[model samples]
Target: MSRSSRVVFYSLSRKFVQEKQAPPKAQEVIYYSLAIGHHLGVIDCLQSRLECPLDGFNRWVAQLPSGGAARRKLEGLGRFGEICIDSTHTHLLATALSKAAPLLTDEQQSWSQRLIDLLQLIENEPAIYLMVRRRDG
Candidate 1:
């Protein structure tokens, strides 16, 4: 699918905040595949950047209520960081986000609603390419 047609999610990393830089230009691109619903080529910004190591990501995942299920699903794929959630597993991701939202730092919580909104969108669509890219200015 064309880039313009995909649903994009942008995240600003700690590095971006520390550098005090502006968001990247719209033309800047980083890509990874995330299988959401029936879509096969969604881009995942988090995994592409390697901002958090696998161990850290695994630790965070372990804290979620549905972490075990999520971990198992992810491990089954033999991949880390990339969030390739299918329709059946949508609830798992949503539940994890809902539980983690309250524990997020104030800055992190600012985007919580947007993430929830995205999940809602996923629930409704038959296929969606969620492009999550870190805004590393």
Candidate 2:
């Protein structure tokens, strides 16, 4: 992603935090797609240390408006997508998650920490890996 892309993402995340309203469907799709892509990357990077199940990941993905299609795309990947999310992006996401944590239901809160941890891990690591799925004919 370019510098501008990062700025756009950070700006969008900050907006999400401040407004406490869901972005439009298009923005939501982009936001969650990038967020989940980065998350899956973090999980893959820390595979030995983490135990993120696909079912759980899918559940989170299902939160998106187009979640069913997103989950199908993820399933097609057959493995982690390789993408990178910088610390700035990760930090913004972490902040957003933390601020929203208190409002989450018990079940949602259970996995929230895992999400926070992954975001924090990206900060410590020199580089964070994220993935984008590709389709082959």
Candidate 3:
């Protein structure tokens, strides 16, 4: 980006980062709105420069940090990855299952189950000795 654009982005970023806290619900709305605004600005800038509306929000979602105590609580379960991907998919899916299940799907689910079964089988198998010489033998 040019120096002026970089300066504006940094200024806006600092404004959002340094804002005063609000009540729980208000805080959520405030931060989310700011994040959406930032994302839009980024998308517009990138599209203008690249000559395409870059459809990489999935990649962006993966790289965004999970913020706040609530985020930690949600992530404590194995739900964060599932929820994050689901949320990101909502923005791009627009009714396409392929886009919706980029990382999870029916066939992949079956494959994952089969792989788990194989792992269990391997875990239950007895060890085999190849070559050994015991001094006491």
Q: All candidates' lDDT scores? A: 0.43, 0.43, 0.28
For model 3, how does the per-residue alpha-carbon lDDT over 1-137 read when each residue is reduced to its tens digit?
12221100000113243345567777667656655654523211110111101122222223223453322322332332222112222223222222324554454344334323333333444121011011110
Q: How many steric clashes does model 1 contain?
A: 1
Q: Can you tell me which runs of candidate 3 are displaced by over 4 Å? A: 1-103, 126-137
Q: What lDDT score goes with residue 122 in model 2?
A: 63
For model 1, residues 1-137, the per-residue Cα lDDT tens digits are: 22232122433211112123335662132121122211433332332212333333344445555536754754442242234444576677667667777666553444445555655666787353243422222
| Candidate 2 residue pairs that clash | 81-131, 82-130, 82-131, 83-130, 83-131
> Local error of candidate 3 at 66, Å?
15
Clashing pairs in 1: 45-132
Model 2 alpha-carbon drift over 4 Å, by segment: 1-84, 132-137
Candidate 3, overall lDDT?
0.28
List the candidates ranked by TM-score, beginning with the highest: 1, 2, 3
TM-score of each: 0.41, 0.37, 0.19
